[model samples]
Target: MMTFNARALVPTIAGFRDEVLASRTACTAAFAAALHDTLAAKLDRAVAALHEEAETEMRLAAGKGTEDGDFLYEIYHTCTTFEHLWMESGPISILDEIYEDVVAEGETCRVGLDYTVIPTEQLGEIGGILDRIRRETGIEFIAARV
Candidate 1:
């Protein structure tokens, strides 16, 4: 039962062109913490909507299942959105927010996200948020399972 998680990796410079594959810390801890907090809030908001939808689905499927109850359980399980996964996975502090070095113009970060069970229905929304993080920070955000 893996859940969704996210991490940001900031790349360092080698005078351009040359890239270092180092997971070294790039930005200040304060900066990273600030981003983490802000992202968490945004994710919370997005997940709220998903939770509501899931609840609605469960309600709609209620009373339909009988002996096995598999139908009911499946409906409930399918509603597990990215936000739900994050909540179930506990605090995000355990995830990796470390900085890394890469060959790119200016500063960049890679966000590694794991344990996220993003349903197909919410991909566009979640993807938009992830993309916004990169655009806003001017950093390369990479989301992957840890």
Candidate 2:
């Protein structure tokens, strides 16, 4: 089983947000750079594992080379292409959950952010979350898949 240490990035993300909100532009930029570094390292390790799996399958298929050679070749090509795109774009799916709290005849807004690095087949889940967030929060969010 593959595991990701997502907790390690929490502090970096929180610090970045805090610095940006504090109006410290340079510090915010630096923090963002640092966050990107962490993100890249984590993503690289995940992609490497995926590449290894794809290569292994490809090798097995090559040895067979009976009637599945073309299919296996196509599958291998697709996997590699997906890995390349992810590495180049650093794609992530982010969901912002917003809620309105009404108390003392006044309303306050609360927002929560959740995100994940989507695998190849789960791309639709990201879009679904964005749609739900917009409907629930009445806020239009622009999300990038990459």
Best by lDDT: 2
Candidate 2 lDDT tens digits, 1-146: 22222233344334433432343333335544443343334435444555555566557557565667766655555534433433333333232222224455575543333443333234333234334433532223333222
Q: TM-score, each model? A: 0.26, 0.30
TM-score, predicted candidate 2 vs. hidden true structure? 0.30
lDDT of each: 0.39, 0.40
- Supply the global lDDT for candidate 1: 0.39
Off by over 4 Å in 1: 1-30, 66-72, 75-79, 83-146
Root-mean-square deviation of each candidate, in angstroms? 17.8, 16.4
